[model samples]
Target chain A: MISVAVDAYGGDHAPQEVIKGIEFALRENSDLFVYLVGKEGELKGFIKGFEDSFRKRINIVDAPQVVRMSDKPSQALRLKNSSMAVGINLVKEGKADAFMTAGNSGAAMALAMFTLGRIKGVSRPAIATLLPTLEGQMLMLDVGANVDCKPQHLLEFSIMGYVYAKHVAGIDNPRVAVLSNGSEPGKGNQLTLSSYDLLSKSRLNFIGNIEGDEIYKGRADVVVCDGFVGNVVLKVSESIPDLIIEFLKEEIKRSFWYKIGFLLAKPAFRVLKSKTDYSSFGGAPLLGVRGSCIISHGRSNGVAIKNAILKAVKFSKEKVNDKIESAMEGCFVLKELKGAVRT
Target chain B: MISVAVDAYGGDHAPQEVIKGIEFALRENSDLFVYLVGKEGELKGFIKGFEDSFRKRINIVDAPQVVRMSDKPSQALRLKNSSMAVGINLVKEGKADAFMTAGNSGAAMALAMFTLGRIKGVSRPAIATLLPTLEGQMLMLDVGANVDCKPQHLLEFSIMGYVYAKHVAGIDNPRVAVLSNGSEPGKGNQLTLSSYDLLSKSRLNFIGNIEGDEIYKGRADVVVCDGFVGNVVLKVSESIPDLIIEFLKEEIKRSFWYKIGFLLAKPAFRVLKSKTDYSSFGGAPLLGVRGSCIISHGRSNGVAIKNAILKAVKFSKEKVNDKIESAMEGCFVLKELKGAVRT
Candidate 1:
């Protein structure tokens, strides 16, 4: 049986959407148990429609305080015993196999790090997202996790990303690439150029520098960068569909002819869009931690929150953290990369 | 009469597309004179259909050498006798008001900086491109110029972008924002946070830090960042539309119903697409220089070439160079941000 902990007072929709998504997932999933952490009364109202057996399967952990989306991440732990922090504590104590949250990402990461700690030899943790590409789904790491990072941090991200894609996404011998301005070996500034050198020398299959255009090309299974650049790319990639959909709505509605085409093309558009949809893959899983954890979008709807819960369960089945720790030992990678030249 | 120097041999299609676009523009326009720079012999085939007045209005300045898109930008001055270089020289020497190229961006900026020199107090030059956004048009600066920059460099880019949008796009008191990972007053890496602090103290209508999602919101006229981040955003933005179009093409061709919609809604789609076309804005203009210049895409078709030439003319008329020099007085705004907190 897989046990997953859900932060009830997490996302913007909170207990309402969270409870709905969890109940929806419970229809055919009999082996799964949930520990919903939030105020009992608030969650009780949200879970009103669930059957008694389903409600009984859900173990409630009292957490009255909620983390606001806008709250500073640094302030999370000090407001100790918060819903998000308490939820993460369950994973650390092994009460749950994996913890999932749609709360403030910064606070979630902060509490996860402080509570669960990191996998041995892993200097820092990284959030790895499976980005849909032309060739296949690629792994991009540190999208929002350590915003300001050293070149070494990027090298570590590549290792974690490569391991995730190989173990979780089922790609073997994943090719890792450092995101840079140009494709040339020496084309980037200090952060990228140095990271490129280290990544190239690591045990993983390392491709040279990759431009932003090749991001969707699946040129590499692992594309690593600092949080700032990665976040910008993620936002731009995510928002493009929203922007296109908005433009199409105004265009198709303006005329009868276009409306016919939009209807016919809707299925194909949905398929292509579904490939890029983050919900299909659940949430960005935090790698390099002692325990498994997944961070969902703070504004995730019912469909997305349900997927996040399943992804957390999958993390337990795969034992992703164990594989990452073993891989680090066999690959004394970063030490061997000290002689590498950035340019 | 505005006379624009057109580098006929600059882009991929060369004299054919450049000549056709110019001829097409001339048939609809009467107040413009064009200096077509290339080998006179090469222009014969493409120019055969136009009348004498059209031919005379489009004068050929014979210069044989064409710069390749792959050539090092630093090597631009060594090829001073080439067609691309000579055409731009005409602008600097007062023979033509502005210079435009569809051939190579690096080459164009190198020649523009070499011939025109930097405006006083401008350490590095920048290029500005108008991105289509939901709220309205947003001006992004340093699209290709300085790959590595200081916080003050971004402050200078803000002022230049602010002026360009105000003077050319007709936006008043154009709100400026430094691109960052979060909207918080102090977020992002050291570079963005510092840049934000400097922008906050600037004379331009500086707004606070803006995340990538808000970029398309059209909340700010000038969005400032280093060339590295700007280039990635610009490249990804440019590639997304083509990617979607490719997906649409494959899907529409497979299904009969979707095919009908593709035809009927085709016109509306075309109009909406034309609005997003970067060529309509001409080219990414190299700013902070003493003379006007426009850098076109290397893969530019005939229409893009013509638009680039026309945009150069507009830059000349707007006297963007002189105005940029005036904006430099506010360049020292970063000094006010020197004591900013590291955290």
Candidate 2:
């Protein structure tokens, strides 16, 4: 059984949605086992109606402390018995194959780094999330992790993204790119310019630079950027569909014809909405951490949570971390950087 | 009469659309005279059928060399007699009150700085463009000028944006903000952190950091960012409407109901398209320069070009450059930086 530790008291929906997610995941994956990390009493009460078959797969782990979303990472780190911390600890202690949380992303990353540590040769862990592209999904890294990243760190993100795309997403020979203001090699700031050179020299199928507009075109399988830019881009992209819908609604109110048209086109709009929906993608993986750590959106629902659990199981089963370590070992630039640092 | 220098050979539509734009602008403003700089023979051929009254307001200046959109800024700078260069020269020599182009933005900035020079105490010129928000519009600066910027540059952008918003855009006590990953003061990279401190200490109506998603909410009148981030954000935002349309089209084809709905809502979609249209905004102003310069999109049509000419005239009439110079004088950060550099 691929055992997973889930933070039940995390995210906006909290213990209720998390319980539903665990029940859904258990029904789907017969071989999956879960340690529901939260207040034991609350979790037990929620699962009281579960059948013997479902109950057999779930075990409650008492984590009396709850980390609030607004709490600083420092404050969260001190709460060692928090659900998020306990779930990560289960992975660290080899009791669970992976850990999933829809809680405070900052707290989750802090705890994961503190408990699980970084993969060898990885300077900083990055959050890798899937963005919908014209052709398929593209993985974008450092979405909210390392805000200030060196060129080497970006290179590491590319390697991790490449492995994830190839192994998990099932893309063959993923094309990696540095997300920049312009697609041209010379058309970036100091950081991207330096990163472009490092990426070009790497063994990964490194396509040059990709502009923001080209991101949705699916020209690159993996797009790497500093956390600040990635986070901004992701949030900005997320805001677009809703803004369009809002604009459409305002326009519809202007005329009777528009109202009728909107009603007919409602199905198409629903499809468009579902296609751009964040919940469908499950969660972003905190790549380069020592264990499998999936961080879902704070607003994630039961469906999203279930998908995240499935994704974590797949990640653990594929042994993505081992592949990343081997890939880092093969990277000459990383070796050179390490040599320079040691000297 | 407010005389304007028009780069007749710049942009995609060139002499044809430019002549039409000149005609339109002349009709809108009786006091406007235009110096249409381009190859004399080609420009004359296009305007041969214009009525005497319209023809009287235009003067053709011979500029044999043309700067192609693909040309590098350095390459463009060497074309001393190109339409873009000659037109800018008109402003530098006080022959025209303003210059407008739909050509290479980098070339426009380089030529404008090289010929007209910077406003006193200004370190660099920035491109400020208006973005449609829920309430009205917000001005975002450094869209594609200086990619890499220091905290002082951001401070200068805020001051310039503030002045423009107050004087030209007619916003009272404009609220200026630094764009960052998070809305919180400390939630940013090294650059934004330093910039936030500088902005908070400034005399402008400085609001705290605004995230990417919050940009469209119209919380602040002016948003300041380094050109790299701003360029990416602008391009990414520009791509959204078209992407949504593409997704909607794909969905519409999947069902008969959607097709019927799309036809009915076609007018509403058109309204949405026009509202999001870049042409309606005319052009981005190259702020902090000594002369009034407006850089239109390369894909500008006659209507866009005309609007840009009107905007340039408004900018000149408002004495924006003079206001920016005075604003810089009042800035303590710029004065302190200058003092430290002198020592």
Candidate 3:
């Protein structure tokens, strides 16, 4: 049985939505167990409606404190008994196989880092997200974990992303590319230019540089970038579908024929929406941390939370951390740097 | 009459579309004169059918050399007699009010900087493009000029963007913003954090940092970013409409109803396409240069080139260069740096 620790007092719709998510997950996986960490009084009232069988799988670990969305990382860390903190501690202490939260992403990342520590040889942890592409989906790392990344950090992200794509996402010999302003080998900022040199020398399937426009074309399975660029790209991509929808809605309201066409084409739009939906993809995993830590969107609903829990379980069962450790062993830059240090 | 030099042997669809664009522009603006720069033999053959009256407005300047899109910036500069070079030289020699090209952007930028020279006190010239927003349009700068930038460069871009928005775009007291990973103060990488500090002290109507997702909301009239980030944002934004259409096309093929719905909604789709069309927006201007220089897309059609020509005329007539010069004179960071140098 895979036990997942979930922060109940997290996300916009806490306790209720998180409780519903736990129930949904429990129903989906009979062998799954949950340690729902939150205020006991609030969580108990919400979960009272669950079936006796579902109740048997759930253990409400009382933690009265709540981490507000606006709380800074330092302030959040001080909230030692908060649901987000307590839940991550559950994973650190080996009480749960993984931890899932739809809380403040920065706070969650900080708590995970402080509690779990970094994996051996990993310079810094990265937030890896699965973005939908024309073919299927691509894994992009350093989404928001490290705002300022050195070339070495990007290499580490590439390594972690390679392992996740190979083991978790099941892509054989995934091609890795550094995100840049241009696709040519020499076309990039100082960061990417230096990164290109390092990535080219690495043993992985490094495919040189890829521009922003070409990222959606599924040219590379894993795209590595600094958190600053990746974060902006992710947010910009997220807003496109909604912006298009808004444009379509306005157009539909302007013409009678368009309204009819939209009504008839609703099914097709539904399919598109589902395909681009972030919830279906589950949560973004904070890679390179010693434990399985998945951070969901702050606006996550029951379905999104449920999917995140499922993803966390799978992430733990797959022993992705172990695979990452082994992959780092073969990293050329890491070894070279270590050798340089020895001299 | 506003005389604009046109590079006939440029872009993907060259002489044919360019000649067509000149014809279109001549038809629209009675006072517009074009100095067509290309091979005399090739261009003369294409324009033989033009009415005698329209022919009076066009002056053919013979230049046998062509700057291919693949040519490097340094190589392009050496092609001194190339169509792009000659066209820009017209503006340099005061033979034309402005220059427009649908050729290589880097080539155009390099030729403009080399011939026309930078505006006094301007460290680097930037390319500013108008992006469609929810309300109207916003000007984003340094789209692909300098891949790497310092904090002061971003400050210069903001100043130039502000001047263009106010003078050419006719935005009243344009709200200038620095694009960053997060919206809050101090929420950015090293570059943005420093830029934020500089922008806050500047005389422009500076809004704080804006996130990528918020750019579409049209909150800021002018958005400033490093060319590397700006170029990626531009390409990514340009690809969205096409990507969405591709997604829709894939979905429509799956069902009979969707196909029929798409056919009925063709008009509305056409409206959306026209609204998002890059051609309608004309071209990006190489701001901070001594003379007006406009760079259109490589795939520019007749309509795009025509619009670009019209835009170049407006940009020159508005005296955007003079306004940018004045704006730079008021720059806080530049003044402080000069003071430091003196000390």
Candidate 2 ranges beyond 4 A from true positions: A13-16, A41-55, A66-75, A331-343, B12-20, B48-53, B64-78, B331-343
Q: Write the per-residue lDDT of candidate 1 for residues B46-92, one digit (tens) a residue.
A: 68778988988888888888787657677666886778899988988
How many clashes would you count in candidate 1?
Answer: 3
Model 2 C-alpha lDDT per residue in residues A47-94, reported as the tens digit of each score: 999989999999899999999876778999999899999999999999
Where is model 2 chain A poorest over a 10-residue stretch in terms of lDDT? A334-343
Q: Which whole-number lDDT from 0 to 100 does residue A25 have in model 3? A: 93
lDDT, candidate 3, A1-343, per-residue tens: 9999999988988877888888889999998999999998878888888899999898999999999876777889999999999999999899999999988777888999899998887878899999888888899988887878778888888889999998889999999999997776657788899888888777789999998888888999999998888888888777777777887788889888888888888898888887777888888999988999998877788999999999999989999998888877765444565432122
Superposed model 1: Cα runs more than 4 Å off: A330-335, A338-343, B12-16, B19-22, B25-29, B37-72, B77-79, B82-84, B249-256, B330-343
Error of 1 at B288 (Å): 1.1
| iRMS per model in Å | 2.2, 1.4, 1.6
Clashing pairs in 2: none
By DockQ, the best candidate is 2
Q: How would you encode candidate 1's per-residue C-alpha lDDT over A1-343 as one tens digit per residue? A: 7888899888888878888878866664778799999997878777777898788779888898988876778888877778898888998888999899988777788888899998876777888888877676888888887877777788778777777888889998888888877776756767887777667667778888888888887788889987788878887887777677777788788888788878877787886687666677688898888888998876678888888888888888899999888776646375556333111
Deviation from native of the Cα of residue B278 in model 3, angstroms = 1.6
